[model samples]
Target: MKELNFFKCKQVIENNNIHIWLINLEIYKKEINNLKAILNSDELSKSEAFYYRSDQERFIVGRAILRIVLSYYLDILPKDIVFYYNHYGKPYILTNTIDSLEFNITHSNEMLAIAIANRSVGIDIEYMYCGRNLEEYMESLFTTYLQKDLRMNTSEEKQKILLRLWTVLESYVKATGKGIRYPLSTDIRNIVNQHTKNLINSNFEISIDTCFLFKKIEIKDYICTCCILEPLDKFIIFRDEFILELPYYFEKIVR
Candidate 1:
């Protein structure tokens, strides 16, 4: 990953490509005030409503960074970015012109990720190294929904596979514009065997349709999945560690 310093926040998008930004939420500790300043009223209210301070910080930083990153692509001020939600509560940018930009956000532990693509996309990350708690999560959250093929290996291996499966499934549903509001037990069987045949063999690819493809991202100690509306092999994965900086326009006084 290359470290870049620039005059203004900038991001580039390519045809049929997705850019995944891995952001370290801990950096928000010192810049919390500056981060909060960039958020809109709605975002600020949502951040302030978090019960835990850590959650609040994450919300503020996450939403603030989301706006900042999105602004570059939209050629708008971060504070001017507008969002509207779908019937299933999936958020979309409100634009006068037809926009193909699509994005998804997911956070695990202190790490947050934002995926931007020109087509439908969804992303999820899971921290499965939570000691014995992972076992409890598997039993309580995933055991019953486990597909026949995913029920392999010992306890530890099973938990890892379950987390991977969970991320893939969740990302798939999110990509389809249905968030967790959709029950997993009823929807779990929707994934075709041929689509997830690579999953059981420890290969990560979930075929949503002829055009949509899913792949697992290899992040140390974290399970992440991304679903995009393009052939997986056609696009190359570019990894970059994002460092949040206040946009230059935010520093200028608007007369």
Candidate 2:
């Protein structure tokens, strides 16, 4: 929480540099009232439309937190920021303050993940749920090749592979802002190959690179991933709570 102050106004987010902010939705629950005050009328109406009390509160908190976080980068009041969504329903900053500001948001249960970068970026976080019919559910969403690979793996291994594959595919479509328009039937196995990672270059067409590029984020009890248009030159994850800290930094950011 204290560290968020150290984040200077408008840090130059480079084209290939991406920063991921992970927020635990529960932490902001206590401030729900204050959070709601920051939301605009449209957001408020959207929150009101939610049938469940918990869902409504979460919606309010998430939108308010997004505005607060973006304010630091845009150097504007949180309430003043506005968003415009594309044809596919992906949101982007509408301000002329900076043309490069692009972001994507995702949440699962109590976890909220946001990715911001100079270039187009997308992120997804999913709770790891290994249900009894996990394979059956995955079969409908995955290509035949991925399904075959999953079938050959043991239960534990299958869960791990299924998590990565599913999340990466999600992140890819989100990055493109194509949403469900992009076929789920893509054989993404070849793009995620280990050998390709060592050979990936920054300069490439959108077609081939989009198929091959995605970063997997390791969060306990969850599967997370991010995708960017170009090769990810720099990647940083800032969490509201101290959770998975490893080869990455151990400190928390954006309370």
Candidate 3:
């Protein structure tokens, strides 16, 4: 795995026409209080900014990490980057300068990931063990074909396969920005089959090529997946290599 260069802060590829940067949120908060300073403002207080659980905090931290990465990439102050929400409530940049910079982000366990391209993109991550009833949930959440696939596997292997399929489905949903309103029982194997056969769904007319990008990483006991809209050839994966040193401010509040 190639390590992303956070210190260099900018990556340029003329031939590929892609730029990517990664920020480890743990390191980010410790190295700079920029995100906290921005969120502390009275304006953002009107928004849902606090979560009662650590999982929610991790989500916010992942978003903050992306903001910091983009700030460095654009050479703009973090506070100056304007954000607005879509109808589905996904946050997106509001500047013309960002028109060409499509991005998506996901977090699982302690790691945050962001993918960028010059076109539309979406990403998703889920903890391998979310402490839920996997068998029951799959029966209700997946289509008949997907359920059949799961049933063919052993108990332990089924759990791992479930996470992998979950990431792929979640990525598709995120990419569509439809959230969970879309029917969970909808045929997913159909989509996967289309991808395999190079066929298009006539109703949606979505090209198999435009449908999904999937990658899975096993981190400790967790499985993390990243999905993007761009062609697979356009991606450059980077795992953060730097050690994180905690700042007293975060430690004080967290403790």
Candidate 4:
């Protein structure tokens, strides 16, 4: 997999653009104390509620990293950021200080991905080589989708196609704030299948109606996908590397 470089400074988000942070949680282990301290009471309590120590640590680091990242953007203290969740359990910033700051988070195996944008955004990252029998597992989960989308591929190719489809479905539902509740089989079959066919291009991006746009990203050994609730031409996307050190070292922009 291509590892994202973590520098020493914080990143700034621009208007009409999406900024993605690819964080490796392992690097934040030593800063557990600092990160934990930055979590608000509710967040801290949620972290403590995790049954496993590792889970608790991941939650703390993830939430804390979110706070620190948002702080850099909003220019507020990390501990001051408040969050509210929608009915589908999508978290949103609750403060009045920043307007239209929307984001989504997804983590897998030690890698955490965050998408920040002015409009609604969703991201999903999955370990491509996870030990699970993807062929069998995906067949069971996405039987109808596979039948419609992967009619021509070999069994091996089908697995790769299936993973891409899964990420697309996941990120789409998440971006719409419906989560998995949106019946994958009935609700989005037409739009999903169309995007699946479009993924044949090396760089594929399409708007499902005027409300949402879906795109697949090429990250080694990982199926990373993103959805933005706007037409593709309306916004720009910036992929920023993670910074491990707890704050301060703003340098030149990567652009």
**Winning model by lDDT:** 4
| RMSD from true fold, candidate 1 | 7.0
Q: What would the per-residue lDDT of candidate 1 be over residues 112-225, giving only the tens digit for each residue?
A: 778888778999999877553444443344334354445666777777776776787778778878876533555445453334446644565655557677777777888888
Per-residue lDDT for 14-93 in model 3, tens only?
A: 23233333445555544333344444344345434555445445545565566655665566655566667679866667
TM-score for model 3?
A: 0.69
TM-score for candidate 2, residues paired by index: 0.78
At residue 34, give the lDDT of candidate 2.
74
In model 4, which regions exceed 4 Å deviation? 1-12, 132-156, 232-242, 246-255
Using TM-score as the measure, the top candidate is 4
How many clashes in candidate 2? 0
**Residue 150 lDDT in candidate 2:** 55
Off by over 4 Å in 2: 1-10, 130-134, 140-146, 182-212, 241-255
The better-scoring model by TM-score among 1 and 4 is 4
Clashing pairs in 2: none
**lDDT agreement with native, every candidate:** 0.69, 0.69, 0.52, 0.70
* Alpha-carbon RMSD, each predicted model: 7.0, 6.4, 8.6, 5.3
Candidate 2 structure quality by residue, lDDT tens digits, 53-154: 999988988888788778767878777888888998899876667767889999888889888898778888878764534556556664566567557868
| Model 4 lDDT, residue 105, Cα | 91
Arrange candidates by lDDT, descending.
4, 2, 1, 3
Please give the range of 10 consecutive residues that has the lowest summed lDDT in model 3. 246-255
Model 2, position 147, has a per-residue lDDT of 60
